[model samples]
Target: MYRANEPIDGGQNQNAATVPGVVARPRAIRDHLTPILDDLNPGIVAPEIQAAHFELKPVMFNMLNSIGQFGGSPHEDARQHIHAFLEVCDSFRQQGAHEDVLKLKLFPYSLRD
Candidate 1:
């Protein structure tokens, strides 16, 4: 099931050679995704919702994050990208939920940033 309480690691490449915070970490991404999953779960269920959402959350988040990056500019684009991404993700997520309910399968999400 899509539990809202799973510990989020942000999917950082743990094996990468890095000192620490210097790396472009996924902390923000994780933070962003947690609430999304929590918000989404009122409508989804799987034997492994926690694992599945964990696997898919970043993809959707990153995609939305990218759109904002493009829409915003030297002035400030993150907001644009984030907004676009979330809009798209929210629509797709609802669709995926409906599909999952019908097929009894997991919804696959992708982040193309």
Candidate 2:
């Protein structure tokens, strides 16, 4: 389960390899995922979220599960969906698993930069 309330400070246990403040924006971790986080209702894989939205992770969906609108919620944003899909593709590529990016949604180029 997603331990959102846990004090995310495992590095200070005195037996860890790294120290505090080494990770750089620990709360901004985009892929902080865990299985069976029951409170999230319909939790999703962390990688499904886009890196750009990492800072807004906590309040992004207002505590809803299944991404911003994967289940057809009214809060759906096309831009967010596109970004999430692209991020997933990037993650797959980083893992040496390539996916053919034939043609995806069209958005303003500036949004990427």
Can you give the TM-score per candidate against the true fold?
0.23, 0.23
Candidate 2, residue 26: how far the Cα is off, in Å: 71
- Report the C-alpha lDDT of model 2 over 1-113, residue by residue, as the tens digit: 22433334644544434445444334434456545466665442223423332222333233223333343356666677666755543433222222332112111221322
lDDT of 1 by residue, 11-54 (tens): 34455444433444335666866654544555545433332333
Candidate 2 to native Cα RMSD, angstroms: 18.7
Candidate-wise lDDT, in order:
0.42, 0.37
| Top lDDT hit | 1
Candidate 1, position 33, lDDT: 64
Assess the local accuracy of residue 50 in candidate 1 as a C-alpha lDDT between 0 and 100.
32
